[model samples]
Target: MSKAIMDLTELLERVENDRELIRDLLLIFKEEFPRHLQALRDAVDSMDGEKVAAEAHTMKGMLSTLSATSAASAAARLEQLGRNRKVCEFQEAYAAFENISKKLLLQLDTCMAEVGG
Candidate 1:
């Protein structure tokens, strides 16, 4: 099997092994991720470099919190591209980030089902 996107091991440790808290945080991430993704996409589509940087930074923070390293790195790259005013240069990074994020969302859904159900 492939590695999971949202690895809770580090997060679980940081939270003192509170599984419930982990579940709650993951739920929050699940609820808000789509909106963030949409905003990022819109920013990219509009070639708004500032918006792209801001959205990508926000995404980086969120993914980092969940220990989603690959996605977070992708987000960081997107942010850097935006910072360089290279919005048009972020197609590859954005695509990779989007793909990873979708996979993470699916993993989160499965986790939430397992924990919240």
Candidate 2:
């Protein structure tokens, strides 16, 4: 089973009762994740399937912290393709990432709402 995705209050509690961790985490999410996302986007846009796969693999590895199951799986698939030089799977990988990211973000939004921010 997957780890339960955390609500914002739980996240805040874990940071030694300081909600500042939420802000810090949000900053990291915004600053670092978009770069990784853009890397995937650019790699995909350029049709450099290997780069796409590599970027996806990197993303998948890091995204595990969020316990976003589909995203992790998508990244794994992309990594396999990139490592194997099998570029044709890019579409499936992209689709997986897209679906997973949406679901995970929605869950996060709900968590945030529950916690008052």
Candidate 3:
């Protein structure tokens, strides 16, 4: 796993503290993550740093709530890059977040399955 998804280990600890919280997080992931991705895709397609930063900030907040450290950090970096007009860095950060997001989703699937969700 990349550094972006590494915080999932800590998130797992949270899940143990409250199954309902995990369920709530899963719902947010199902709902917000897709929208976050679309915003990112549109930002990338348009090469709009403003939109990129907005989307990255949104993703960062959501990922932080889920305790997805690596993804959140990646998103934060993208947001920062966008804010700084560093398009190349933003693009790289977006790619990193994309990878981490996929891995997180897959891991979530397994977690949900284990709980018969």
Candidate 4:
């Protein structure tokens, strides 16, 4: 099997191995991520570059917290496109971000299942 969606070792270390805290944060991520993703999709579809940047920035922060580096970078790309008001470039960036997000969510779900989260 592949590795866990996120390697929480560092996170746990930072929290001194507080398992409950880790669980809580993961649960919050699970709850919030889908909504954030949907908002990003909506912003992209509407060609609202500013909104896309805002949503992507938010996603970047959340993904960074989980150490999902590639996914976070995908979000960052979208954020940059939005910041630059690159409407023509939005489609490809949005596609990449969306694809990465789907994979990331699958990884998250697998990890959550393993942990009985």
Largest TM-score belongs to which candidate?
Answer: 1
CA displacement after TM-score superposition, residue 100 of candidate 1 (Å): 0.4
lDDT of 4 by residue, 28-78 (tens): 988998899889889888999999999999999988887778788989999
Q: Between which residue pairs do clashes occur in model 4?
A: none
Task: Write model 3 residue lDDT over 35-91, tens digit each, in one string.
Answer: 779889789667788888898999889888778777788889888887787876766
Q: Write the per-residue lDDT of candidate 2 for residues 1-117, one digit (tens) a residue.
A: 533343444455555655545655555664677788778877866768679777887777656644455567777887777777676767667777766666665566555455455
Candidate 2 positional error at 109, Å: 2.5
Estimate the overall C-alpha local distance difference test score of candidate 1: 0.86
lDDT agreement with native, every candidate: 0.86, 0.65, 0.76, 0.82
Estimate TM-scores for all models.
Answer: 0.91, 0.66, 0.81, 0.84
Model 3 bad stretches (over 4 Å): 1-9, 12-16, 114-116
* Deviation of model 4 at 62, angstroms: 0.5
RMSD of each: 1.5, 4.3, 2.7, 2.1
Report the lDDT tens digits of candidate 1 across residue range 3-58.
89877667677778777877887878888988999999998988888888999999
The weakest ten consecutive residues by lDDT in model 4 span: 2-11
Ranking by lDDT: 1, 4, 3, 2
Better of 1 and 2 by lDDT: 1
